[model samples]
Target: MNDNNKDDKTLNHSRRQFFKISTALTAVALTPSYILKAADDNMDDKIAELFEKRDLNIEVNGIVHTLSIEPRVTLLDLLREQLKLTGSKKGCDHGQCGACTVHVNGQRVLSCLSLAIMQDGKKITTIEGLAKGDELHPMQAAFIKHDGFQCGYCTPGQIMSAVACVREGHANNEDEIRSYMAGNICRCGAYPNIVDAITEVKQKGGTI
Candidate 1:
């Protein structure tokens, strides 16, 4: 009877060991599926990120640039952040102050209100691009001669708009210049000097 009891104990220990090994094997087999699913999820995220970015090619300051950017990026952000062209001010990003004015296809548009994706394959001109190698543009020179700015924060936008004003034949008289340039606000009250600068450029009638 002692030998039979010993045999029963051995059988129980063997059963316990067998169950432990079986459970470990099952867990090991299931872990690979979970890992594979996690890997697939990560791969899907990577694919989504890739799809969200788009290729953009634009010409700025007479130079062509190719960029990969998100669709929601603004033209001001693209110019200042990516291209390092910070001449355009960001005051009143809501398009009320006209501080971010720039030329698109020879027409003035608020850079903050414009999207970068919409400007793909289009021409853009900033204040930095307005000058030649060592000579400033005619409008810039006139602004310097007339002191059209006070703090100089709004000078870039002002100069850009002034150039457009002359090019579009809107600088005929003081009232017209004021009416056309009403979008640009000078907190320092430099309206008189700004008018003088635009008038000088228009009288000269040289290439703006």
Candidate 2:
């Protein structure tokens, strides 16, 4: 080939290689910026949530407590996990079971379905709070007397609901007691005994 033709071929090859290298570098630079930005945004969101917690001030069973908890924390978790009040069982965390029943502002509340952060400045009563120091509440005593529980896993919630039933004036009769206490489910089938206990408590008529 002539020298002029050879020089022209070399120049064309060099130009092609330069464009290839520039395109590769540009893609590498541009692709990483988008990927890195997405990664950074995800990391920022996780970091923000990791330190996110709200202050909660509330009373439980006549004792006031100040706590800091995540907004997603449920009242049942706050009692069992944080405050160590495990009497309110965690059965059926979806609120189907009554094992997590407790009192919030004098009404029966399903703790598992309730958010602790939303209960700020509210009064909560767990099964552990039903008794006065070493003295069982009347409903607790009645439950024992009537053998209202067998496995006893559902007893705490049962007793709590029972107290609420009597206080709510729903225990006027056996049928009424059964109707109000229906929310509490005893796997051992202690409904009859539970009804008996609540009936006795209601009939006593002193202080529920």
> Which lDDT tens digits does candidate 2 get at residues 1-208?
6785566567545654554435434434555565345444544343333334556888998889878677889999999999998899999899887999999999998999999999999999998888889999999999999999999999999998999988888989988888888888888999999998888889999887
Task: Report the CA-based lDDT of candidate 1 relative to the real structure.
Answer: 0.85
**TM-score of predicted model 2?**
0.78
Question: Candidate 2, 202: how far from true, in Å?
Answer: 0.3
Q: Give the local distance difference test score of model 2.
A: 0.83
- Residue 87 of model 2 has an lDDT of 92
Clashing pairs in 2: none
Candidate 2 Cα outliers beyond 4 Å, as residue runs: 1-51
lDDT of 2 at 178: 82
Which lDDT tens digits does candidate 1 get at residues 1-208? 4785566557555654554445435434555565445444544343333225566789999999978677889999999999999999999999998889999999999999999999999999999999998999999999999999999999999999999999999999999999999999899999999999999989988777
Clashes of each: 0, 0
